[model samples]
Target: TPIKRAWIWHYQRDDRKIFIKIGNILNLNPSVVSRNFNKLERQGSDPDFYAKTSISERPRLITPHAE
Candidate 1:
């Protein structure tokens, strides 16, 4: 799926400190993309499969920056 690939691409990139405008590129809602990103984050925990979604531990790419 494009979403999964996009997420992997995100994970692979070193210059992904900022969030990608997936909504602008794919025309999907950012919320949906975020939800799936959370899912991907969980799935990243291979054997344990017990990934926790913490506000502090979330990937920087998905987190909103303070201005």
Candidate 2:
């Protein structure tokens, strides 16, 4: 459920780029990702949900350079 919780946290934060990246990595549409996150949120009853660890900072994407 940690992954699900993390997705919910990201969705709640309104991080559009993160959702796009998630969709790209998962081979899904960004809207599909958003819809799934919404479904997860509706399934959960926790009103005060927050990530166990602090993640206020945006995630950085690191790509390796080809030699």
Candidate 3:
């Protein structure tokens, strides 16, 4: 779930537009995104740390296929 990892990175960085944009591109609700991040936080998982290590690779934009 690279996208989720990316979202966490952006969230930690307070990159509002980028994280929101990621959610929009995935057709995800903002609450869903926030909740997922919160859940990880409550579990004592440092998403930012993981994201920093894992997301060193640049992210590529991916267009969703039309239904």
Which candidate leads in lDDT? Answer: 2
**Residue 23 lDDT (model 1):** 43
Per-prediction TM-score to the true structure, in the order listed:
0.34, 0.42, 0.36
Output the better candidate (1/3) by TM-score: 3
Residue 12 C-alpha lDDT in model 3: 55
Instruction: List candidate 2 segments past 4 Å from native.
Output: 1-4, 7-12, 42-67
User: How many backbone overlaps does candidate 1 show?
Assistant: 0
Q: What is candidate 2's TM-score against the reference?
A: 0.42
How good is model 3 by TM-score?
Answer: 0.36
lDDT of every model, 2 decimals: 0.39, 0.45, 0.42
Candidate 3 residue runs with Cα over 4 Å from true position: 1-19, 39-67
Candidate 3 residue-wise lDDT at 7? 41
Q: After superposition, how far is residue 34 of candidate 2 from its true place, in Å?
A: 1.2
